[model samples]
Target: MAFIQIIEGRTSRFDEMQALTEEFRERSEGASTVRRGIETRDRDDPNRFMVLVFFDSYESAMENSNRPETDEFSQKMMELVDGPPTFHNLDVLKDETS
Candidate 1:
């Protein structure tokens, strides 16, 4: 089944966050594991950001999450944020059909 991961955080360092976004884009570009991704900032809360990532399957998502590039990117993400990020892993059942 296709899976989605939602990552939410508040950033104190915008420059570092921008760099991390670039790094994530670079790492995800050629990755066969990632299906799609969208990053957005909360309209009501400027410090809040969310990333929605999709994968072909749970296993593929886990594999990508464990990659060295992902690990390094995660580290940079941590450094750029104010608090620990909240992650939600979900199985996407229906979308367009719904």
Candidate 2:
């Protein structure tokens, strides 16, 4: 099944968080497990941010989560937020084309 991870974080450190996310994007370019990701900011609350990450499968996501690079990325993410980020794992049910 296709998996989606919805991550939410505080917006106080948007710039720093964006930089960290960009770094991860650059490092994960050639990674086969990570399919794609999008970063979004809350329209009402500027201090709120969310990241939608898609992986080929749950197993692939787990594998990518365990990589050393991911650990480093996690560390960087922690530094830019007030509290721990939230992650919601979901199984995609439908697509617009379908």
Candidate 3:
């Protein structure tokens, strides 16, 4: 099943975060298990942000999480945020395209 991880947080350092994300993408390259990702900002709150990351399976996500570079990236992300980020892990039950 496809796995999605939703991460939500408030950050005043979005530009820095964006740069870090780009760096992570370059570093991970083919090693990353992420199939897709969507970055969004809350309409009502400029500082609030959310990221939805997709993986082929829960195991793939777990594998990415276990990577040392992933850990480093996560720690850096925490530093840029106002507080601890909220995470939601979901297993896709249905997916359809027209």
Name the top lDDT candidate: 3
Give, for candidate 2, the lowest lDDT window spanning 10 residues. 89-98
Report the number of the highest-TM-score candidate. Answer: 3
Model 1 clashing residue pairs (backbone): none
Candidate structures ordered by TM-score, highest first: 3, 2, 1
Cα lDDT of model 1 by residue, 6-89, tens digit:
999898676678777786787678864788888888888989988899999999999998888888888878877999999999
Per-candidate RMSD, Å? 1.8, 1.4, 0.7
Between candidates 2 and 3, name the one with more favorable lDDT: 3
CA shift at 14, candidate 1, in angstroms?
3.2
TM-scores for every candidate against the unseen true structure: 0.89, 0.91, 0.97
Q: Residue 74: error of model 2 in Å?
A: 0.4
The sequence of per-residue lDDT tens digits that candidate 2 reaches over residues 47-85 is 998999898788988999998889899988898898998
So what's the TM-score on candidate 3?
0.97
The superposed Cα distance between candidate 1 and the true structure at residue 73, in angstroms, equals 0.3
The residue-by-residue lDDT of candidate 3 on 1-98, one tens digit each, is: 99999999999998999899999999999999999989988999989999999999999999999999999999999999999999999999999999
Error of 1 at 17 (Å): 1.2
Query: Which scores higher on TM-score, 2 or 3?
Result: 3
